[model samples]
Target: MTSPAPRDRVDELTVGSGARLEELVDRESLGQLATSFADLSGVGIRVFDAEGKLLADAAQPVELISYLSTLKHSRSAIESTVSSVKNLDPGPEGQAGIDGVSGGRYRVVALEHDGRRVGRLVIGPYFPPSLRDIPSQLLELEPALDLDRARQLLTMAPRVTDDSMDRLARHARAALDVVMFSGLRALLTGSMHLAAVRESYRELQSKQDKLQVAYDRLKELDRLKSNFLATVSHELRTPLTSIIGYSEMLLEGIAGEITGEQREFVTTIREKGEQLLTLIKGLLDLSKLESGTMSLRKATMEVAPLVRDVAQTMAPHAKKKGISLQAEVEAGLPALWADAERLRQVLLNLVENAIKFTSAAGSVKISARLSSLSTGGSADEGGLVLLGAQRTAVELRVADTGIGIPESERQRVFDAFYQVDSSSTREQGGTGLGLSIVKRLVEGHDGTVHVEANEPQGTAFVVAIPLKRATLRP
Candidate 1:
C-alpha cells in the first residue's frame, strides 16, 4: 500500500483547548470545496463518529436509501477498527483494512492531525473482514440476495495508496488555510468601508456648524444697523425742527423788516430745511420697518380713489417741473385689503421719486390694476391672476421719462442709505432713505416694491401689494 503507514501520527496540528474539531474548518468555504474533493477521491469516502453516526459522505446516491442503510451497518465495523488507532499517538497504531473475503474488504481510516483524533473516514463498502468471514449480518438482511454478488459490488471502493492518504490529508489542511485567509480579507474590507462613512459624516458636521455661525452673525449686524439709523434720525429731527421754523420766521420778517435779498435767501433756507426734514423722516420709517416695529392699520378701500388721490397730491410738483402727470385706475375695481396709511406712503414715495427725477416736459403716469402672483412672500415675479377686485394684488406703477436707474443700481436703491449718484452730500438733495423706506413699508403690508426701466425712456417704480396678509399670520 502506498499509504503513509502512520495512522497515529497526528500530534502536530492541535489549536487550543475548549475548541471543537469542526472549528478547525474554515466555515465560509468548507461547503464549497469538500464536495469537489469527494469527487476526485473515487471512493465512498464518508466521515462518521466512533459509533457510526454519519457526518459527511460523498459517492452516496440520494435514491439508494435501502442501499445506504446496508452500507451504514457495514461502515460501523470499519469505523470500529479505525477507532482502535485513536489510542496511539502520531505514528502507525495498526492497519484497519478488511481481509479478503468476496474480494477486498473496506478500510476505515482514522483521521488525525497533530496527535488529535479529529474524525474517521470510511473508505469502503468493499469486502468483509476475514476475521468475521462473510460478516454474517449482511447475509441475515435478505436471505434471497446473493452474498457473493453483493460482496463484489461492496469492494469497489477507492484503493488509495497508504502514502497517498497521508499526502491527501495535508492537501485538505492547505485548502482550509486558503479559505480562512479569504475570510480575513472580507473582514478587512468591511472595516475600511465603515471607517470611511464615519469620517465623511464628521466632515459634513464641521462644515454645517461653520455655515450656521456665519448666518447668525450676518443677521445680528443687520439688526444693529437698523437700530443705529432709528436713533440717529430721531435725534436729527429735533434740531431740524428749529432750523426750519426760524428760517420761515426770518422770511416772513416776523421780528423786523428784511431786504428783498434777505427774504429770498431765508425762503431758500426754509425750503431746504423742510426737504431735509422729509429725508430724515424717511430714514426713521425705514428703520422702523427693518426692526419689525411698523404697525399696520388695515382697511378695505377702493383702488381708483386712492390712485386719483396720490396723483392729485403729486400733480403740482410734477407740473412745476413741466412733467405731465396722469392717473389711470381700472374702473369698478374691487376694494383692497390693505394698511391704508402704509399703502398711501408707498404710492406717494414712488410718485415723488418719478416727478423729482423727470426733466421738463417729460411724462409721469400713476396706474393701478389687479395683478396675479404665483409665489409666496411676493419675492419673485410669477404667473398671477387678478380675482374679484384682484385675488392676488394691486400693482401701482409710477412710470416716468426720467434718468433711468442703471441696472446695477436698481437692486441697491432699495437698500438703506444707498443711491446711484450719492456722494458724502449728494447734489440731488434727498436722504437716500426714500426708496428703502418705501420697500420696507410695502413689505410690512404684505407687499413688495421694485423698479424697472420705462422702456425707451426712463424708470418705473412698481409696488405690488397683496389684498390679504396671508404669508405671515398672528
Candidate 2:
C-alpha cells in the first residue's frame, strides 16, 4: 500500500525561539478545557507551558491526599511526588507516569504543535483498579495512622483501569491540539505582517537617502556655475568698454578722415559692441542676484514720477520704431519703498521687450495706480492673495500691443535664458536674461511680478510693490 502523504509544515526558523506556549493560547481557554475534562473523567488535570509556569489547574479535593497532608512524614512524601511529576519528561512517545504516596498514579502527557513541544498536561492522583488497598509504604511513614479512617479515605479517590486512564489522557491532548493550532495560525499571521511593514519602511528610507544626496550635489553645481558667470562677466567688461569707446571715436572721425562706408562700418561696430556690453552687464547682475550679493539702497519714492520717467526715457526709441509710447499715472498714488535705480532698470527692460515685440503701429502704455495686494494663494494662481490680509501697494503695468505671448509659455518667461522665440531666424534680439533680472529685482523689494495677455493683442507685465518697507535679504 502507498504511504500516506507527509503533512505540510511551517519553517521552524521563521517562528524562532521567541514563540511561547502562553502566547499561542490564552490561559482562560485552557482552564475551561481542563475543568471540563476533569469533571467528566473524574481525574485531576493541570496544564503548564514550556517554561514550567502553571497556566491552568482543575482538581477535585481528594480526601486521602488531604488526610495524608496532616502527618509530617506523609506530607513530605507527597510533596516529593508532586515535585517529581512537575519535572517529568514525557519521552518520544509523549507520555509518562509516576505513583503517588497514597497509592494513586499520575500521568504526564506532552503538548506539541508543528513538531515542537510547547507545553504539557498533567493528569494525576487517580487510583487504578489493581490497587485494592492502601500501600504498606504509606503506613510505614505514618505509624500513628488510624487504619479504618485511612481505608475510608482511600475509597473516596477515583478508581480506573490503566487502559482507561491512558485513553482519557489521549483524548484531552487531542482537544488541546485544536486550540494550539488555531492560536499558532494567528501568531504566525501577526509575525508575518510585522515583518512586511518593517521591510517596506527600510526600502522607503533607502530611497529618501539617495534623493537627499542627489539634491545636495545639484546645489553645489549651481553655486559653481554662478561663480563662473560672475568671474567671466567681470573680466570681459573692461575690454568691452574700450572697444565701444574707440568705435564711437572712429565714427566721429577722431582717427583721421574716413570714407562714408568706413563711417557706417564704425557705427555698426559700436552698436553691436554696445549690445554685447549690455548682455555682459545682464549676466553680471544675474550672478549677483543668484548669489544674494546685490545690495539695494531703498528709500520712500513716489510711483507716479517713476512711471513718467520710464515712459520719457523710452519715448525716443519708441518714436524711432513708429510705436506710440505713453504713461498713465494715477494722481496722489502712494509712495513705494524701493531702490530707484533698480526699479528704473526693471521698467526699462520691460518697455524695451515690449517695443521689440510690437509692430510699428502698436502702442506701449506704462501705468501706475494704488492697489490692494493680497498675500493669500500660490504664486502660479495669481498674486499671493489667499492666506493674508490686503495690503496697500503700488501696481505698475507695462502693457503693449506686441505679438502676444502664448498662454502655455507665460509662466516660463521669467526663467533665466528661456525665450518664447528661440529659433535662429526669430526677429527680436535679446540675451533673454532681462525678464529674469526684472523678477529678482522686484522680489528683492518684497514685490511680485507676473505677465498676462493684453486685451485684444500683445502682453502686459505687472509689478506690485507693497508700501511698507520689509527687511531685505542680501
Candidate 3:
C-alpha cells in the first residue's frame, strides 16, 4: 500500500516563532540538495531539524572513519565532531561556524525561514590543502597505527577552502526552496479540483430528486383522469341511448305521421345523437383499457373473410366520399389467435379513418399476409434461452392517399384528444378518440399497430397479430 502523506506542518513552518526547517522543506528535496552540494564542493554534508533530529546526510568517504575506528581515541574524537555539528546553534547574521577537530574542521551553517532559526546544514570534515603531515591525535590513538598508511588515507579526503564551502551551502538551500514551492502548488490544485467535483455531484442529485417528485404527481393526476372519464361517459351514455331510440321511433311513424320537413329534421336529430353516442362509447372503452378491465373473447379464425367483411361494410362510406376502397389478402394466409370481435373493430376503425381522410378520387387499400416476424432474441444459448423468438404473425396494412400526417405529428395522433389541427375553424371534423381507442384495443390482443408515411402521398397504419400464442423456439 502507498504511504500516507506527511503530518500537517503548515502552521509549524509558516507563521510561528518555532518554525521548523524540515516542515518548510521536504525530506526528498533536502537529501538531493545535500548530495549535490557535497559532490560540487568536495565536502561531507548533513542536515538536522530544530529539534536536533538528523534528516539527511552525504558524508565524506568511509576510508578515514574505517581506519580511525580501529583506535578508541581517534574513533571517540570523530564521533564528537559529528555530534557538535548536529547540535550547533544558529550563528549571528546567518554566518557559518568552523570548528577544528582531530583530523580536520567542520563548517556548520544554520538554516532560517522568516528570520527564525529552523535547522542547520553541516559541510565539513574536509582537510586543509596546506596539511603537511599526519595529525598528532591519530598517531597517539593506537600502538598499531601505521603512520605511512594514515598519511596515504589523509590524501584521499577532499580538501577545500572556507569560502567555497559557504557558497555551496547557499546554493543547496536555494534549490530546496524551489522544490518546496512546486509541491505546495500541486497540493492546492488537487484540493480545488476535489471541491468542484463534489459541487457538480450535489447539483446533479438535486435535479434527479425534482424529477422524481414531478413523475409521482403526474401518476396521481392520470389515475384521477381515468376515473372521471369512466363516470361521465357512463352517465352520458344512458340518456344518449334513450334519445337515439325515441328518434328512431318517430322516424318510423310509430308515434305519428311526421311531415316531409319534420322527417328531415328528425333524421338529423337521430344522426347527431348517434354521433354523440359513438364518442361516449369511445371514452368508455378507453377508460376500461387504461384500467385493465376490458375483456376480449379470443379465438382462432381465418383472416381473409374478416378483411373482406370490413371492406364490404365500409364500401358505402368510401363510395359517398368518392374514394376507391380495396382489400387484398395473401393466398393461404394463416389464421390468427385473437378476439374476433375486437379484431373486426380494429379493421373497421382503420378502414373508416382511411375513407374519411381521403379526398375525392383518392384511394385506400387494405392488405394482409402471413409473414415471419423477428422478435429480439439471441441465436445461441448455453443453458438458458434468449427472450424473443422468431414467429409467424398476420400482418395487416391499411394505407390511404390523403393529406398525409406530418412525421412529427404521427405519434402524437395516437394520444387521446391530441389533434394535428385543433383550431376552431379546422376543416377535419373528428373527436380525436378513434385512433386512441384503436391503439389500446390492438395492444390488448397482443398485437402491434403503428402509422408510417405512404409512398407518393398519405399515411399507412400497419398492424401485426401473432398467428399463434408466442412461445420459445428450440
Candidate 4:
C-alpha cells in the first residue's frame, strides 16, 4: 500500500513522502496547491515538467514575457510534425518523439511514487536575495525579459546557505509530492482530449465518404444539364432567328397593315427575346467556367488600357446614377499575363458593383499598385514588416462611397446565393452569385480578396494577385 499524504513540507519530504496520495493535476490545480504549500512553509514554490517545461510558474508576469505565447502555440504543431517524422521505423524505441528540454532556463526533477515516474518539478533562475539583478551569465536571455515582475518573482524563491543544499533538495522533493497529485488530473484531461480528437477524426472520415458519393451524383446531373442546354439553345436560336426575320418583314410592309397595339406588342416580344438570349449565354459561360471547360486565351496585355476600357464601358451607367467614377491606372503599367476577355469581364463586374452601390454625388475609385505578394515571408524589423524576397504582387482596389458590410458578415457575403439583405422580396435585384463567382475566378489565378470598410461610408474590395513575371532591382 502507498504511504499516507503529509500535511507539511517537513512531514512530506522525509521518509513519509511515499505515503502521499493526492491525484496529479495541471496548471490551475498546481497553482492553487502551490499556494497551500507556500502558506504552510513560506517558500515560493514552482513546478516544471521533466524537460524543464514550466508547468506552473505563478511567479511570472504575462505582459513582460514575449514569445512565450508563440512557443506555447507552436508546441502542438511541433509535437505533430515530430510524431509524423519519427514513424519511419517499426521498432519500439523509434516512438520516442517528444523533446525532453525546455528551450532556455529552469531546472527539473522527476516526480515519482511507488517506483513509477509520474511527472516532474522545477525550481527557477530567480536571484538569491544577495544578488541585485538577474545574472547575465546563467541564460542568454534579453535584458528586457528581466523586468520588475521578474525581480519580485525571484525574491520569493526560498533562500539558503550552501551547507543546507541537501535540505533544499528535500524541500523540493516535498513540494513535488504536492504537485504530483495535481499532475494526475492533468494527465486525465490530456487523455480525454486525445479520445475526443480520435472520435472527431472518425466522424470526419465518414462525412468525407458521404461527400464523395454526393459529388459523383452531382457530376451526372451536371452532364445532363449541359446536354439539355446545348439542345435547347440550338432549337431556340433557329426559332429566334426566324422570328426576327418575320418581324423585319412586317416592319417593311411585306405583310398587310397591322394595328398599333399589335406592332407595339411585337416589338416588346422581340426585345424580351433578345434579353432572354443574353441570359442564356451568361448561363453557358458560367457553366463552362464551373466545369473547367473554358479555354483561356493568354496574352501579355497592357493593364492601363484594360482599366480605362472598363471605366469607359461603365461610365455611362455611373453617369445615369449621377455618381463620379475615378480610374487611377498608372501610365506605362506593365503588361499582365491574362485572358483579355475574361479580365475585362472581371473588371466590368467590379465597376458595375461600384456604380450600383454609390449614390448621386458619391465617388467610385479604381486604383492599382505593385507590391510583394507573399504575406508569410516577411520579417518585422524596426516595427515595419518587410518581405525577404522580391516577388510581384498587383493590388487592385474598387473603393465605393456606399453601404458597407459589417466585419462579422464579410466572409459570409462570398458564399453563393448569400446577400446582405435576405428579406422577402427586397429592392435589390441580383442572383447573389456574382461575388461568389468572382472569388472563385480570382482564387484560380492564385490571388486573394478581402473587403475593408471604405472611410466614412461604403466598402473597399482589395484584390491581391501575384504577377506572372517580375523584374528585381539590382
Candidate 5:
C-alpha cells in the first residue's frame, strides 16, 4: 500500500545475512549486463537490490505504454501495475509473473549469490506467445484510448514463450554471479588491510603512552635531585667556612704561633677547605639555576669594562701558573643589558679554566668585541651566529694555548661534571661544574656560549650576549 522509499534512503539500510546487490557490482556494470541480456533475449529488464533500491534498468521503449500514459485512467492503471510488479516476491522457486491489461506480461526472477538471494531481475512488458488480443479491461479503462493505435503497438512488443523467458532470466543471473564473486573477494581483501593498519596504530599509541609516563617520572626524579643538592650544600657551607677561617687564623699567628710544619699543614688545610667551599657554592648555584629560581639584577653595563674586570680577577691565577694572560676589549662597543655579577662569573670561570690547562709560557687571552647574530653559521668556527633575525651582541672569547681538547669531546665539556682530562693523574683539577654554570648563566641572559678548537692549539670558549634587555629570559 505504501510507496517504496527513495533509492538513497533504501541504500542507507545495512546489508544483513545477504550482501546488497549494489555492493557486489557497480551500477554501470549492472546496467551494461542488463542491456546486453535485454538485447539478446528481446525482453526489457530492470534490476533492484534487496531493499527495493533500483540498481539499473535497460528497457526498450514501448509505444503502448507511452500511449496509455497520455490517458489519465489508463496511466493510473499502468503505474499501479508497475508498482505491484516491483514489490512482487518470486517465492521459494525464485520465479513469478504478472499479466498486464494490455495482454503483455512481466517475469520476476530472484538474483542469488553464494546460496543467498541478494536482489531480483524484472524481465518485463513482453507479449506472451499465447496472447491473441488486447484485453477489454485496458480498452474501457480510459475513454480517450485510441483502439487502432493500442492494437498496433501491442503487436510491436516482443513475443516470447514462457520457457524461453525463464531461460533468459536464469542465464542473466548466472553472468552476474561471476561479477559478484570477484567484487566480494576485493572487498574482503580491502577490509583485512584496513584492520591490520588500525591494529598497528593502536599498538603505536599504547607504546607512546607508556613512554610519556616514563619521561614524566624521570623529570620528577631530576627535580627532587636538584632539591637535595641545594639543601645539602647549604648545610655543608657553614662548617666549611669555619674550618677555612680557623686555618687562616692559625697560619697568621692570630690563634698563637705555630711550627713551620704546623704552618704548612694549616696552609694545606686552608687551601683544601677553600676548594671544598667553592665546590659547595657551585652546587648551590647549579641547583638554583636548574630550578629557574636564580634572580638577575640586570642593568645597562658596558662589555669592555666587564671584560677588563674579569681578566684582572683571573690574572693572578694565570701568572701563578706561569701562563701569559691578556685582555683585549674593543673601544666604543655597545652596552649589554644583563646582571653584571653573573656575567663576571661566566667570564671568570672561562678564564680560570684556560689558565689551568695552559702549559708554562702558554697564552690565555680574554677579548670582547661587537658582533652581530644572524640566522646562519656555527658559533665555534668564529663569531657566534644563531637562527634568528640579525641582532647586535657582545662576543667574548677566552682562548688559550693549552692541552687541546679533541673535537669529539669539545661539546661535552659544557655538560655538568663532564671533564676532558678525567684521569686520576690528570694535571688540571676541577669539579667540572664551572663550565656548566657558565653555560646556564649565559643562557639566562638569552646569550649563547660554545667551545671550539683554538687556532693551531688548545680550546676557545666563546660567549655571545645580546644587547637587548627585552630579549633576556627570566
Candidate 6:
C-alpha cells in the first residue's frame, strides 16, 4: 500500500523559531509582493521557495526570448541561458548575483527570515546600459540571425543598472520581512487566545466534577445521619419512659411517704426525664420526616380555638419570664384543612420559642386572619380569589418583641438541631428541634411557613394553611 501523505504541518511558529517563508506567506500575498516590488523597481521579479516551488512572478519581458526562439540554434542558446539563470543559487544574505543571458543579465537575491535562508527572489532579465552589441552566445548559435531585430528585442527588455537593481531588491526584501513579522504576530496571538479559552473550559470542567463529588459525599453523610438518629432515638425512648414513670411514682408516694426535699428531687427527675423523652421523640420524628415516612392525620379545624389554646398554654411560661403572651383571631375567618394536634404542636413550638428568645417585659402575639393568596399578590386583596387562585387560607403569625433572630439565622434555625446561639455560654437553653419539628408539621398540612423581621424589633413566624381540605394520602 502507498504510504499515507505526511500531515500538512502547521505554519505557526513559536517565538524565536525559524519558519519557511512560503508557509508564512500565501499565494495572493506573494503575488501582491511581486507586483508591488516590480512596480517600484521597473524590473521583472519572480519568487521561489527552498523547495523550488514557484510562488509568484511579475513583469517578465518576453520580447527578447520570444524573438530568439524563431531560429533553431538561437532558440537552443536562449533556452540554455534561461535555464542557467533560473538554476543560479542565491548565495548569501544581502548578496545579489549577476547571471549573463544571451543578450542581458539576471539579478538574484536571497530571502532570509529569522537569520536563516528561506527562499530566493529573482529580479531581472534586464539589459545593462553598457551593452552595445548582441552577445556571442546568440551570434555563434545562429550566424544568419538578424542583429537589428535581436538588439531591438534586447532594448525592449527592462533596462536598469546593477547598483540600482540591488537597491530596489533590498527595499523589496525589507518590505516582505515586515509583512512576515506581522503575519507571524497575528498567528501567535490567535493561538494564544484559543489556548486561553481551552484552559478556562478545562478549569470549569474540573470545578464541576469536584462539586459533583462533594455533593455525593454530603448525600451519603446525610443518609448515615438519618440512620443513626433512627436507631439511637428508638433505643433511648424505652428507657426514658421507665425513668419518667418511676420518678412520677416516687413523687406520688407510691414507694411510701417521702420528705419534702425527696419529693422535690423526684419531681425534678420526672421533669428532666420528660424533657429528655421529648428530645428523643423529636429526633425520631425528624428521622422519619427525612426518610419520607412521617404520616399526618388531616382534618378541617377552626383556626381561632387552636391559636387561643396554644397561646394560653404558653402564657404562664411567658409570664415567668415577665414577657406578655396573647392571641388574636380575625372575625369571620374560615377553618383550616390541617391536622389539629400537629397544628397545635406547631403553634406551641412557635410561642415557646418566642417566649424563650424574648427579654424580660417583651411580648409574644399569636394572630390569625383570612388571607387570599395569588401568584403575585398578598392574601388580603379584598378576599377576591381570581381564576386559578387559591381560596383564602388562615395565616397564623406568631410575632415577638424579643432579642430578635438575625436575618441570616432565621432560615437555618428550622433545620434539625441547628441553634441560632450554639456557643456553650449561650443564655437560652433547649434541644434545637422545636422549630424544625414545627416546619415539618406545617408542611405536612400542605401549608407554608416562613420567618420575617417583625416591625421595629424582633421576628415573626408566619404560617399559611389552606382552607380547602386536601386529599390526604401517604
Best by TM-score: 5
- In candidate 1, which residue ranges exceed 4 Å CA deviation? 1-201, 377-391, 423-427, 469-474
Candidate 1 per-residue C-alpha lDDT over 7-42 given as tens digits, one digit per residue, 9 for 90 to 100: 111222112221223444443344445566666654
Off by over 4 Å in 5: 1-19, 26-44, 57-61, 69-80, 92-95, 129-132, 136-145, 156-175, 178-182, 374-388, 469-474
State how far residue 266 of model 5 sits from its true place (Å): 2.5
Task: Report the number of backbone clashes for model 3.
Answer: 0
Q: Tens digits of per-residue lDDT for model 2 on 1-474? A: 222221211223264234567877888889999999989988889998877889999987788998888888899999999999999999999999999878989999999877778889999789998898889988887897888998998888898788998889989988998887787778777666666676688889999999999999988999999999999999999999999999988877888989999888989989999989999999999999999999999998877778788888999999999999999999877677789999999999999999999999999999998786766665457554466766678888999999999999988999999999899999888878999999999999888899999999999999988788352212
Cα lDDT of model 5 by residue, 133-176, tens digit = 77888767777788888888888879998888877878887888
Any runs in candidate 3 off by more than 4 Å, and if so which? Answer: 1-165, 183-199, 245-269, 290-302, 337-339, 370-393, 440-448, 465-474
lDDT of 6 by residue, 1-474 (tens): 232221212222253244466656767888998998778666788888766668898967668777778778877766776676677786744565664546567777788877776778877777777777787766776887888988887777777787777778788888788877887676556656666676799899999999999999999999999999999999999999999999988987899999999988888999889889888988998899888788887777788889878977887899899998888999977767678988998988899889988999989999998774443444446544343455466789999998888888878989887998899999888989988888888777667788999999998999887667452221
The residue-level lDDT of candidate 3 at 84 comes to 71
TM-score of each: 0.62, 0.80, 0.67, 0.49, 0.83, 0.66
The lDDT for every candidate, in the order shown, is: 0.64, 0.87, 0.77, 0.59, 0.84, 0.79
Candidate 2: C-alpha lDDT: 0.87
TM-score of 5: 0.83
Query: For this target, which candidate reaches the highest lDDT against the unseen true structure?
Result: 2
Query: What TM-score does model 1 achieve against the real structure?
Result: 0.62
Model 6 RMSD in Å is: 7.6
Candidate 2: segments with Cα more than 4 A from true spot: 1-18, 26-47, 53-71, 103-105, 123-136, 143-168, 329-333, 369-393, 467-474
Query: What are the clash counts of all predictions, listed in order?
Result: 26, 9, 0, 14, 0, 1
Better of 3 and 6 by TM-score: 3
lDDT of 1: 0.64
Which lDDT value does model 3 have at 176? 59
Off by over 4 Å in 4: 1-267, 375-390, 422-424, 470-474
Can you write out model 3's per-residue Cα lDDT over 1-474, one digit (the tens) per residue? 222233222212322223356655678878887887777777878887766778898886746667877777777777777677666665685655655434677777776665656667777787777776777656666656777887788888777666666676677666655764555555445444555676688889999899999999998898789989999999999999999999999999999999999999989999999999888888999999888889987877888999999999999999999999999999988667788888888899888888877899999999998765545643345333346765677889999999889999988989999878889998767788888988988888666788899999998999888666543222
Residue pairs with backbone atoms closer than 3 Å in model 3 (clashes): none
